[model samples]
Target chain A: MQALVIAAHGSHLNPDASDPTYAHADTVRETGAFDEVREAFWKEEPHFREVIRTLESDEVFVVPLFISEGYFTEQVIPRELRLEEWDPEKWDSDGTDASQATLEATDVGKTIHYCGPVGTHDAMTDVIVQRAESVTEDPNVGEGVGLAVVGHGTERNENSAKAVEYHTERIREQDRFDEVEALFMDEEPEVDDVTEFFESEDVVVVPLFIADGYHTQEDIPEDMGLTEDYRLGWNVPADVDGHRIWYAGAVGTEDLMADVILERAADAGADLGDAIERVRAATAAGTGDEPRSEPEPGAGAGD
Target chain B: MSESTSDLEALLAAADDGVAFDGLRLEHEGDGYALETPDIERTGLDEGALRDALETVPAYVSNWQYWQREIRGDGTARRAFLRRCERAPLADDESADHQPVADDVALSVPERYDALANGIDREWGQLCITVRFVDVENPDGERVYDLWHVDDAGNDLADLEVYDDPRDARALATEDEDGRYRPLKTAPTLRSGWAFTGLSGQELVDAVEFFYPATVANWHRELHGELDVDHWLETAERQTGIYDVIDELPREAVDWMAEACCVDSQCLRRREWQYEEGDDLEVDGGDGAFPCREPCSLVVAAARKWTVLESEEERTYELELTTSELNQLTDLIDAVAEGRTDEVREADVYDGANRYRARYLRAKRFDEDGNLEATERDGE
Candidate 1:
């Protein structure tokens, strides 16, 4: 039997980090695509170290429910999951030139296909565009609306910014939105100075994050002048400097993420088999062939 | 018949007599065997169908198969501990008279299984366990379990913080009822008002590990004779850095240290380690559910300080104290050791450990530098 393991960076302080992972696993489980759909987390129980042993399936597809291909995806996860024994120190000097291809390993009758992080998938461009469009009152985002794809970048891993930059450039190529800018929470073109980089009065900020924990709920909103009180929920078209900052939920929380995770698994050579048809049938049955609306930011947006 | 088949038939016959084997009931009715669990009931089942039902229902299968094959014999301690957690009937002749004690309600087999649908609450240390049988009709179904702080067991899910990730249990386990940070995760002071709901078997075990790290593994090891216990002497010898001095502590002082730190009041793990190999300390190791295989990091750190204090040469000093004051000191030590210092009332002056009594003793005996007026250490 085939099993799908959605590995994520959960949080001891915040349960919201692993929420979306569970939701996606539940969605996948409903499809009867895999005999078992399990979730593993770096900071949560059923940890990466022991998660694989809990499954009964021999063929397992592990999809990292992360936003980028950086430290965790390359080093910490691979080591903890026993996917490989790589020196973490070499991760930086080795540079981003390391193969971004999926890593597969067979041990003790189980074959684990480690797929790429869902955030870097090509289909995420559509997810982000859909998210940006779903939030704003403006029917056409191209008519003067500026889009800022926000990522939590760090100097520790230069590749962290690449995913956001890649998707930002990809969206820019479509030339659908009036302007597209890649913003970072940690690095240059900070999300805090978002209005300074965009001239459009209507700016849609979509956090390129896997979960809506501290960053999406507090940091990004606070930085964008969305809320001063540091609250839990946010209303759209938040006024900042007399301009509308239409803040969408973290892009990873989008329902299409179920599709994206499956796509990533498929790209990793996991035979979708009848799961592809099941996903289509589920999509048709649930959403009725319409584009998904913007999701509310909070829990179940896997951290 | 094969031994396994005979055992299955024996189990079936036991169930037929209305014996509920950990919430599973199989009865030989007028037609065929009627197999039932908390979640599903398959009626008109022949011997093969009954076997199929038993093997398919995870709650039943995991309980019986694991119990019969592993827990019934000279099984691992972890398996035995798990049996205790489920309130399963004792398998050995040593406890032959002991049976699973149910409530006063003498419900029928079907009614009994139905009663378990809401979950059977059990306590493991400070954790409240709720074992739930989810969709047992499905062959690949699971025996989902939820873990909450024992204090939060009665709280509604809506009123309490609901968590799905087991890792989040660390945060809940980090503090006490009064919000003070508990340095020891297994200090019997795990904060309440949080629950990890709908966890799989592995997730349940993982969450328990986060709350009380290595308790399950260590307990299993100790039971299987695989536990490598580092006693006080050996553990102290291995210590380096500032803790290297811990080896200098007197053997009797080590006993006091165990008394101060390893008991049930201070830690929820039974102290399995002693002063040295085949050498037991005079102090009573706690009766905690799990065993402490070695001195924890906290114990080692505390032992270093204790070693330094113990190294000081003993000195005699004359002191003036009333009989009441002398008794109050003993009361104060007892109160502090039992974590009841807060319970001593200021108004209750008659009680030796009362706040006002303690203050009176301090006022009369303590010097300005917070030292006893008539006493000084040898160095001083």
Candidate 2:
């Protein structure tokens, strides 16, 4: 049996940090592409250390649902998952090749294929462009508007900025928008500088982060001087210094992310052929179970 | 084969005609086995199919089988606790003693299980377990559960934040409603207004673990007679860094530590570890569903501070106090120790812990520097 595991950075203080990962897992499960789909977190229960033990499948494919290929994807994830031993001194150091898409290892008689994070996927350029375009109903949303891709860049790891720059360069090459610039939360050209970086009267800032948590929902918007009141998701275009700014939600929450995750799994050479055959055989035998359903009670509606 | 598997095989054998066990009914039908539950029934099942069916009969079996085998073995505290949540058949008079939070004893087995769709809420520590079916209308469907803070049990799912991932429950457990960080996740101060809805059996157990780490596992171990409790002395000896000084704490001080941190109001876990091996503390270990295997880090940290304070030589200072004032001091200590300081109303001046009463005492007895007037440490 084949299983898909999405590894993410879950927050001990923010309930919404793992929302996109669970949503993507649910979407993947609906497709019946893998025998099982589970999510593991770095900071939460069923953590990387124990997620492998929870799976009954012989073949496990793990995809990091992060927006970068830095400390987490290269080091912490692998070490925590027991694919590599964590050297305490090496915590602050880096040596793993950032370009490697998949790392295959064998642990406890299971073939573990650790796929690259969804953030650095080539298709993310399209996700970012789609987020920017879908932020407003205005037909000329992308026309004459400068697009700023905001990432949670850090001075600790330069690779975090690389993924944002990659999408920025890719979008710039498309030449669909007037200008595409990359902004960071921690590094230079901060989110607060979005207005100064773009000379256009209208600018669309798309957060290149994973989930719509503190950074996307509060920090970035506050930095852009949009609203002090923290409301989730895309906001109405706010006027700042004669510039109309449209702040889109985090890119990872998009529906198309399910495709990107599958793409990354496939690119990692996860044996999808066997899973596809199993699903087909089950369907032919009329044994394919109905899609899992959740109870809808008179209580509260979930996000 | 494992004992449980053998027991299952025996159960299948005993079902040659018809037998009901743990809300499941099975019988022989034309060389095949027929299985039935209160909500759903299936016939024409061979041996393998019978086991598969037993593994998943929707209303109870499938949801119960995995967790029963994985997280809960027979006779485990967690198994008993989960059984209690589902209002599973009582084995003896002992189980009948602790009534369900929402008593449905009048309802039949099927009626009780069916009512799960509306959710039967039960409290475990600060967690509220809502046991309900995934699809009440579907016979072949399994049960799904939700875990929320007890305070959020009756709140609308819309009013409280809803979560499906077990990992997300950590955020709900890490702080109070006011957002003050809770150093002890097991403290009764678990923040309300968040629900982990629509969880499968394993997901429910996993979410509980996130909310109160190792609670289910420890409970399971305790029930299986495998809980290895490290007493206060051993736990203190194992401590390193600045915490190593905790081992020097006086024996009576350990009793105070247990009183302050291990009781039901302070922590949800019953203290299994004692002052030393088999030397139980004078204080009650609490009535929690799970057992704490050792003094938690908070206990150790607090013990370290207490150890240093205990090292100070005894100091005596005479102070005149009215009989009422002396009684008030006892009441104040009891209020603080029982964590009812906030519960005592400020307007109720008769209460010793009342804000105004406490302020008056401080003004009368405490010097300008806030030290007790006319008293000094012997060393000073």
Candidate 3:
């Protein structure tokens, strides 16, 4: 079985935008679970259309390294890769139906199992929780801390905002923090209104983006007055009103997501249990032979 | 200096209209002297209070003399004086002595200019004046001052006339239109057209510093390399309404799309746009339209799926399947897709078979209801 991760590449103007995706892919490739683990991109090389042509595996599992199940997953991925025939009318309003559910292969000789985008998985909430905790000055006590899940909401699509709200609820259910609010860059209950949303003095804002790109690195920080500098992860100490605000890197960049990717592959019939155990055993033995694959010569190393 | 009644009358007689002493008088009080401008009727000061006010007369006279000297030499000081006159009476605590040296006075203009002033105000915007220094060589080098309209913000909004004579620049500095100080420019540089003419370099820079503070701050930031390309790009993006939606996509997808087609499809000019395999997607040919301005159908579809995944509400479905039954179900899916339905039937006896059968039944019901067009089409 082979694993193929698809992502949107960073812009030429801003190279660091796609760094997290490449970093995550490199981490997953080191696990040696699949015969091959290669990443394809929509904006960079190798292009998605050409990526499949390069594949040698008869059975492949494709996982979208996306934050949501938006236009890309339902339309673009299926159409480009010819994974499945998607008819909006055939499925329920939620776009999920038993007949159309997971791991259905196409008629071609290749068996491709497409998994849900990494962002929507139940385990992703844990990643968000971890991100919030990592940046919080005091993680043990969430009494005064506010968790703000910020997303790029659009008037073009209500689903975009809904996805953010979904994650907000999941993180809120953990009951770890005093408050959890879903905020957006372009919509109401906006990022600018974060100060009003939280009564707590310490607010941890985790961008619900898949990659630490422009919105995460530039827009969010500028809006929050976290820093004028644009980079990934924790910004310099910042505040809104009198509340201390901590900014985390995008939720998708977390290392635990490698595990989630493997789990998704497992659900798609990749059977990673043995390979994971092998990798774990190698790590436990301190063998220093952790099967980390060297990137292809032309594959750009993220900064 | 102390003077008798005759000396006071003589000083008042010599004062002209410009001195602002039309109805002035002086009166002696207990152990002090009272001097009144526009008379005691307007001032409404009692004899004892007027005596105390007389002591401040020396300081006020000295301040007025100093201001006259400064205003004569400094165009900015003159403008400040004129601005103060246009407004109401200066508050007792608020005086020319207390005003800070305008920011532009401290800024050293490039050596090319004989005089320049850049003033910035958050409320009123920016003002700038620059006079070019020219050296003409004959037998002796002759210095010439030519005032040029240079938009320091790079925004050509100031309607300024180039002046060969320094007097013209100075005259324009003090010029007033409609009772307000003219040449007070407003942002974002496209809308401003006011240009103050006659001012000394210090005054011009000071006016600019006073008028458009943010522009000066931005200039300072740029000069120090504190304003990075990303910051500028972000600012440009915000102003132009060019959202960073590309960043919202996965990094790999961004790279692939950049290689495959123009990621910016909104500006595509062609009626029926198609991304040719080897076509250059990066170049927009100055039209803001890349070869493909919008994502390809594939990317759009995938993005839709991603959105759905992101927005979809979570619901837990618990299933109790034995190891063998789970394996069988997994196997059956592959077998069915591979057209090995016989193998699927063989696994029908598994513990999860009833659940799987129920799904098939539900699907059959949907199919009978004419709701499963995709399934029906696939079967055909």
Candidate 4:
């Protein structure tokens, strides 16, 4: 069956980064729709490279949880995974079985196809809007309240902050916010530099970053002075900035991340199969490059 | 599918010795081992030493008394306090068995900081610092403020916040949906303050002292955590010759500060609080001049500590400071320039951060007319 790999910008030192991937993988596994599902991270274990060769399903789908279409998604994961290119230019215009045959001949799985990162999807706007709504009790999200859509913007790449453009645009189209603006931890529209841009004293700072660190703790508070009282801690368990300012945890820490992976698999055209035959095929052929004794059925496949 | 981190933590606790996470050999699976963190390293040890080290933790975590009460009186006395520590010193026989953290000690702050700060000095990579403001009510007869500081610059840290106010403080969550911040809310009535307890080296102390007590405390700390320590100096029990909490003390005392200051107490004014976001320099090195090579955002080196002090009479403000050793070197430089090297012996007494610094004679060279040219930098 189709297996979904939720790739993330994970950290080993801090558990918060990769935990979302693990948590969503658990939820996706519980659905039992996919024969296999797993997580891979840039910074932590089950790294991007080894995780790909370990997948057994005929059709494998990868969905990056990164918030930007920057270098990581465009260059790093592709080079490391050895994934076949998805450019349609090499294909016959008639949409025939030619490419499939070419892939099969080249020893690339005919069923293997990759979709873009889930972060780039239009559906993610809904997730952001929902997250904003979830922070407030009422569905009324930030009426006259300044919603600072905080992104980990960097001067190293303008495109790093450009994702905020897409997010802010999509979020605005949904008509869910009273005032929505973009702020960065590093780049222009720098969070601290333009806190008044939101125009509302009641500002909700949402980290579009995968995991929280200095920006959330020092930069955000030092600029806003919202948490001058929360000394010794940059992060205060989702609540410490006071009601005048609300902060949503990093966007990847959501339950619906698994849904995004499933959507990516559908886009990649995953081949679903009965559990019995798939398990038998995976065990007999040996899913890993080197053959190993069979696992005790479903043991450790999801990790 | 079954791998939950909490489940892993529970298993780590239950196992007799080190156990692989999710029963997968990490090295074979191609990821370096992920089951350890130096912060919780003590949890991995045998029972007895683990228990003894852990016993000090709850108290350390729950209050700031250990930090602010660091017994800063006589020089030899301070050394004795440090040698003794807070909890009983690890028995000499048990010293070898003490594995203080949960992971390999390589992840320890000092070790990591050494590696990272070395890189910074060598101009390798940028550094990041995580500053946390931890305020816990030590209802065990004291109220103290603590700042938990971590950085890429190795284990050189500073977690020093003392509540001069005699009031107890605790964590509270107030949620207002319409407000900007969420579940972790402070009472609009909550007022407290915090200060930087440590600096990079003794060189940075004077600048910190000048900036914080002047700029940040007036604007922030007086509105947030501890009232000014200067407030109770003369009026506090130490000055009144009162060894009592209730009898002769002023009405607004929150908790007794164990140390007595021999300074005059004065009435500190409470300013009207305002926080509309200020204009910016796009700090955090956004210039691409010095970019972060890693995917993570590189942070600057600074300790960010805050405290919330609530009061019936006094107001709280925020305090933020950074410093460096003022120029004590030129005296020695002048000593050499004049060729009278024997005067170098006098320069040794200028210990700025060490609580004693000698006032060096100011240097003023005469212009065409012999007069005070204001060319000398004063020493405190």
Predicted model with the maximum lDDT: 2
Cα TM-score per model? 0.55, 0.56, 0.41, 0.37
Q: Which stretches of candidate 3 lie over 4 Å from their true place?
A: A9-12, A88-108, A137-141, A228-235, A274-303, B1-380
Q: Write the per-residue lDDT of candidate 2 for residues B229-285, one digit (tens) a residue.
A: 778888787655567799999999888878777889888889888888768899999
Native contacts retained, all candidates in order: 0.00, 0.00, 0.00, 0.00
Cα error, residue A63 of model 3, in Å, equals 0.8
Which tens-of-lDDT digit does each residue in A1-303 have in candidate 2?
788989988765666677788777776776677876877876554466556645557778888898876767776677656664433233232322232333344344467777767888876776677677567644245668899998888776677788888889988998778889999998898988789999888898889888888778888888788876666433478888888898887988875577667767777676554333222222221223221111222222111
- The sequence of per-residue lDDT tens digits that candidate 1 reaches over residues B1-380 is 25445556656756566445556667778898887766888899887788877656544544454454434433333344444444443342233343323212243333423544666677778898886556544321135678887777778888888899876775676567787766566787777777888876556775776687656655555544555666888878865556779999998998899988888878888898999988899888888867776677678778878988998878878788888777888999888878898887768888888888887889889989998778554654
Error of 2 at B52 (Å): 24
| Model 2 spans > 4 angstroms off | A34-36, A42-54, A73-79, A82-112, A138-141, A228-235, A269-303, B1-342, B356-380
lDDT of 3: 0.47
| Model 3 lDDT at residue B14 | 32
Candidate 1 chain B weakest lDDT stretch, 10 residues: B100-109
Candidate 2, pairs of clashing residues: A300-B157, A300-B158
Q: Which is the better candidate, 1 or 3, if ranked by TM-score? A: 1
Q: Can you list the residue pairs that collide in candidate 1?
A: A17-A303, A19-A300, A20-A300, A45-B167
TM-score between candidate 3 chain A and the true chain A: 0.80
**Model 1 chain A poorest 10 in a row by lDDT:** A294-303
Q: Which is better, 2 or 3, measured by DockQ? A: 2
lDDT of 3 by residue, A68-166 (tens): 666766565665554565544332435211112243334334666667677766656766776665565343536668889888887655666766788
Measured with C-alpha atoms, the lDDT of residue A26 in candidate 3 is 57
Model 1 RMSD in Å is 11.4
For candidate 4, write residues B187-262 as lDDT tens digits: 1221223323322211121121111112221222222222232222221222111112222332232122111110
Q: Can you tell me the CAPRI class of model 2?
A: incorrect
